[model samples]
Target: MTILSNNSQVTYSGTGRRKKSIARVKLTPGSGKLIINGLPGETYLQFSPNYLRISYSPLHILGLSNEYDIYIKTEGGGLTGQANAIRLGIARALCTINPENRTALKSEGFLTRDGRVKERKKYGLRKARKAPQYSKR
Candidate 1:
């Protein structure tokens, strides 16, 4: 059976996390161009090109891509974090857009959110799990 039925269209959602920050993204199909919260990133360059390399959505969103279209809204993260989140969100949304993509996306590990974070410092130590230097007097 196909992952997505013919002409299937669904909303895509995903959460992105990066070093002490988190982001959420929502994606939807549009007319041959990406539109993000009504803002055109092409003129403003709201995000770095490294992040934009993820897909044609943002490029189209910024009116830079020749084909493919999407709209995205992201919140709760730094620039890099937001980009990653948006990437994952877009990947997931792609699955929603066409379930046939889910397997490939999942295999590429694009659907998983990075959950690593700084560990809490210990009360009696100089840092997390680090003990004070001892000097015998």
Candidate 2:
């Protein structure tokens, strides 16, 4: 089931994607705790400052960093992709809580989806754009 449809009066939810990663985020009233895949955010994201910053960008941008709890369930892709996906999901969930935030979030580009993905390799290519080696002999 999608996160948006699963939201209740007390919870706001959003779904986000980046590369091969997908994140479902839920926002609820509580201490400013963050959970990812059933683990604490700090533990799941490790000590990477970049991951923490990227994952919490949306909340920080809106000055709501310590207002609510963040719960994320993500799969696919690497750490960076998962972080960005969670950021987008949180931004969307915030918009659900207060539609007025939509303008600010959209203006900040958090509402825009990243469509970039790896291209498939061609039949005769080593990679998406890499050509096979030439043998002049």
Candidate 3:
């Protein structure tokens, strides 16, 4: 993704994806308050603590979790996918603030985009690869 905005304010903006989820992330200097889809991050992702942890890992890794506010508008997938996508978005946005951050994010594998997705089912198959058993008669 690319920086959608930058200047004196609105420090950075970036997009991130995982599976089918897409996250639009905005980074600003402030007390770390993460908001998702207009809801507080903790409230929006309360389904699992893991979701919170995954989405916050990048900031935690950089030791800037409390220095920047993260706002995410994510859609197109389940909570797990959205969480991961947001994680990537945060890492990428951080890169804009400091190019050196790329090394740390890359070293931590946060910059690598996951390419695995659900396989399409073939005609006559029960699922992606399962097939019906033939009758011997």
Candidate 4:
């Protein structure tokens, strides 16, 4: 939960990193009119069902102002990663919305980036850090 200075109507943007993808979300103080590349809610399902809910439901959470415009730009990774990225971005945007609520958001661990991901295999003719054909003869 980082506290950022309040900037006037500049469309507060936040960056969230998850897995192998990144999400950039822009938020403004206004009626809830979430616009994603000029698409409606149905288009979100095309990418992923999990992500669709994460992106479009953050505002509905308690202590969040419903009046706002949410815009998200995400690239790379799978649907799950995208959804996580969106969550982080939205949490950051909340900071810009009301610096006072930073504590609340932080308590929920929303402002933190989840750095857990699949590990790559090591060069050993087997899985990562694992050896093959161990004979106990």
Worst 10 residues of 3 by lDDT: 1-10
RMSD of 1: 6.3
Tens digits of per-residue lDDT, candidate 2, 1-137, equal 22333444377789999999999998887778999999999899987899999988888888998888988899999998999999899999999888899998999899998999999988988899999788999
TM-score of 1: 0.60
TM-score of each model, in listed order: 0.60, 0.91, 0.91, 0.75
| Candidate 1 wrongly placed segments (more than 4 Å) | 1-24, 31-38, 42-47, 55-68, 125-137
Residue 53 Cα positional deviation in candidate 1, in Å, after optimal superposition: 1.7
| Per-residue lDDT of candidate 4, residues 1-137 (tens digit) | 33233764557788888999798888776776666545643475475666666765456564454677677777888767877887888888777767876777787778788999878988875876678988999
The regions of model 2 sitting more than 4 angstroms off are: 1-9
> For each candidate, how many residue pairs have backbone atoms clashing (under 3 Å)?
2, 0, 0, 2
lDDT of each: 0.57, 0.89, 0.89, 0.72
For 39-114, candidate 3 gives per-residue lDDT tens digits of 9999999857899999999988989989988888999988988998998999989898889999989999998889
Off by over 4 Å in 4: 1-9, 47-49, 56-58, 63-65, 129-137
- Indicate whether candidate 1 or candidate 2 has the larger lDDT: 2
How many backbone collisions does model 3 have? Answer: 0
Query: What alpha-carbon RMSD in Å does predicted model 3 have with respect to the real structure?
Result: 2.4
